[model samples]
Target: MNLNELRDRAYKTACDHGFHDEELSNEHCLCLVISELMEAVEADRKGRFAKVPVDKKDTIFDERTFHYQNKYFAENFEAYIKDCVEDELADAAIRLLDLCGLRKIDIEDFTEEMLYGAEESCNDETFTESVYAISTIPIRYEYEYDYPLGGQLNSMLLAIFGLAKHLDIDLIWHINQKMRYNDLRENKHGKKY
Candidate 1:
């Protein structure tokens, strides 16, 4: 499916998982996204990757039990561990998509605009420079919009996309896989974070 379709699906998945049960403030959403990014950073630091338990019946998605059975990690454990950064990056995008869906933002359009802007900025600059430049795009919304957090949210989404590109991650596929795994979590990943 296309980006918009993916966004819709991501949003629906979040709702199905009870992420939309309460009205979260923009700052809260931003924090949630950032937390995922931090998790990615931590995963990278420890050379960790996302893995399913070998014994699916014994798996518990709760945070407390999530990492209790490293020995029973699924096959290709090494490869999956190496992909921790990418997995976390996908998670960040998933969070952003869910937020956009909740806010009724046209994420596909914004993503296109930001990506083009990033490309243009990279013509005479490094990728890092381009990302820094793109990060500033949210300033306009910060003051002009009633929901000032929109700017922050947009900036985070842009950065996530940029990182995904750098990491060669197919966010659509990762999001789909992550969501499917999430679905298998008890109560749809409820209280797991």
Candidate 2:
């Protein structure tokens, strides 16, 4: 998945949906990313994951849109596939990518750099610990003096991709589904923030 393209799409979608109506502080953007990571941690603790049953995998994508709009699907399949650990990770990635797009960072390069080494580096850290570490990486952009925010964000993206790999998540698929869902939602997703 070309990350820069996804970044562009994510940011554009956010702007179109009114998230960009006013200037957003970097802290606020990273806070949203951290929020998604926190949700992932909760999903892990609760044993939630986006595991499409083997029998359903073949047809899930074919009927993706139908299920996305269905109340039953929203309650059941949504819990299984949309509010799971992997999906939350995808949300975290999308949030970061949107930030990168807003700042015009070249995330595709960072994504390519991290692709092969992802599953190899995070073996020593538990999933929750690693996620916590990733969450911390983005905050440095707000407080540290003279550190390039793009580079710090790229580092966080590396950690996020590593977690995604360790979990065997098809993040691109989840991100696509999420982008569609985001497009259909109310402004600021009905949140005051």
Candidate 3:
């Protein structure tokens, strides 16, 4: 699915699981996304990434292999996807997508080239620095009344995609998996959010 469709799907999953019982401000939503990014940083520092067995890596996310036991509960489970870098990045992106859906931020006109440009335009900063950049994007929203929140979110998303690309993470797959995982979770995904 394209970003818009993913946004819808993410938001729907969140709503079904009770994340939208009350409206949240732009700041609150952006903070949640930032929180996920911080989690990604923590995961990275600890050397936890989303690796499957070398043999099954390519097909690990396939429908038949998408079970939690295979993805996160297997023998080497802790060494892989549970709150790993890739998973947390997916969570960050999912949180951003969820916000887009809630705010009705229609990014249908945002082309792949636009995303490419956003990524290319970024400074060659460290991953943590890039996360810092993303964190700063939304803060400007509060002070810049004329600027659209969608623009900030789009920039934030590009940084996310860029980091995923740099780290060679199959972010889309993780997002799909996390969304499914979230679906099976309790209200508000068992969090107070």
Candidate 4:
């Protein structure tokens, strides 16, 4: 569905769940939409969310240098990428909502539908059609293409931010920070693809 349709459904669903009429109104729906956009954002405060790591080399510790001797060194790069995405991207959505005045209760009630839809669609087939899923794109270009799976997290983020405004919170500052974080390095100049 297009963004507008998803938005309408989310708002309607929130209203049905007993939020105040004005609370789940168009403005609030927009915040929920942002949360839906950033479905990767988890409410967990635990370190379970991806951990950011900085490269540190200590020649004095032979053990540190010994890691490269094993074939598993490449895996660290993968972990680094995952950490960058999980740490910065997901946190941005949550912080934006919080900054915008989205109460924990507000997020709980309004975010279920969006989050559920996103979680359900997290499958190989859906991912194969994603924007970054170029490998799944067929050589033939006759068929039209759309990214139903690529931006669920982004949708969640939008939903929450919109809802925050309804709660009387302004999150322009947080949103800007998120934009900067997301624009970080996407391509490698050397080594692995």
Candidate 5:
């Protein structure tokens, strides 16, 4: 329910998946998960489990997305960005818990009162240089021992995968299933959502 509990669930899931290596970074694992998700998205498009597109990279930190997220919208956007990131993070957390034999209800119990915050500082004249911030600092520091944003993202992702495991769905597997749904399939205008 807390960060430490979440971390324990995540670490155990990683170990169960055979991710053994002291030097292996959380960044590395997060990258792997994102890569897997992207690949799964592509594979679904092809109607089979294939490789991910070489070009689809992490746009979360992309220059343009960051530019907009930090610019004039800094004040108003902080909440939106935080919400989006949290959804992704929470989904990741749920997935990880699922993998660890935990149920969705269990995760809901933890999330009930999670305190999340968002702040921003911008300086770029052209883009309104701003820092779009969203965090649960207490939870982040308690689990990772560092304030790095990547840790928060990874912890959330681990939980997500764990949740997926419980539902007998790999991240990619679920994406593929979504692709089959008319509401989710790309309709030439881009993804349905």
Candidate 6:
């Protein structure tokens, strides 16, 4: 499936998991996405990959659980560490997609623009300009004018895409895996960090 299709699926999955039932504001959604990005950074620093922890039984299944070490290593340690980064990045994209779906944004267009912008940013010598260029996306007030997070969603997506490219990760595949894992969670991955 394409990115847009994935966005729709992620949103639907989140809804099925009760993300929309809680009346979350745009700020809450943005904060959740930011939290996921922070988790990605933490995962990269600590080398914890895969959702299952070494001491699975002891985990509280809350936001703090991402720091736990994984005992279920089926491959090289380096690959596992990379996978942790991939998974966290995927979570970031998934949360952004969920927000786009909730707010009825044209993420396909936004994604296309982001891709072009990213390609352009690749040639630039400075990182700050690239960041500024990617973070700027026009906001529409059609569907939910009162929501503030809608404006920042594109920036989040651009950041995730940039991070994924830097890490040499296939975001779509990781997103699919994360979504599947989310589906099987006890409460739609609600207990997960």
Q: What are the models' TM-scores?
A: 0.63, 0.85, 0.83, 0.23, 0.28, 0.63
Candidate 2 structure quality by residue, lDDT tens digits, 1-193: 6888899999999998889899998889999999999999998999998766434445645465334576554455465577788788888988888899988999746445566576666788888888877887756555664558888787788778877877777777778778877877799989987
Candidate 1 global lDDT = 0.60
Best by TM-score: 2
In model 6, the runs with Cα more than 4 Å from the true position are 48-83, 109-151, 188-193
lDDT of 4 by residue, 1-193 (tens): 1333333333333334333333333334344333433343332223333332222344321335424344443354335423332433334453324323322223233354654444444443332132122212222222344423223334444433443333223333323323333233233212131
Query: Positional deviation of 1 in candidate 6, in angstroms?
Result: 6.1
lDDT agreement with native, every candidate: 0.60, 0.79, 0.77, 0.34, 0.34, 0.60
* Residues 66-139 of candidate 5: C-alpha lDDT, one tens digit per residue: 33334443432334322232223333343343233222122333231222111111112111111011123225
Residue-wise C-alpha lDDT for candidate 6, range 1-193, written one tens digit per residue:
3667877998988888777767777667766766666676676667655543434354432223332242322232224433476787787789889888888876545455675565545564343343333333323332435434555575557656765565455666567657766664455455532
Report the number of the highest-lDDT candidate: 2
Task: Look at candidate 6 and give me any clashing residue pairs.
Answer: 61-191
What's the C-alpha lDDT at position 168 in model 2?
Answer: 76
Error of 2 at 11 (Å): 0.6
Candidate 2, superposed: residue stretches over 4 Å from native: 53-57, 63-79, 110-113, 139-146
Of models 2 and 3, which has the larger lDDT? 2
What is the Å distance of residue 186 in model 4 from its true position? Answer: 26
Per-candidate clashes come to: 1, 0, 0, 28, 24, 1
**What are the root-mean-square deviations of the candidates from the true structure over C-alphas?**
8.2, 3.0, 3.2, 17.9, 17.1, 9.2
TM-score, cand. 3 vs. native: 0.83
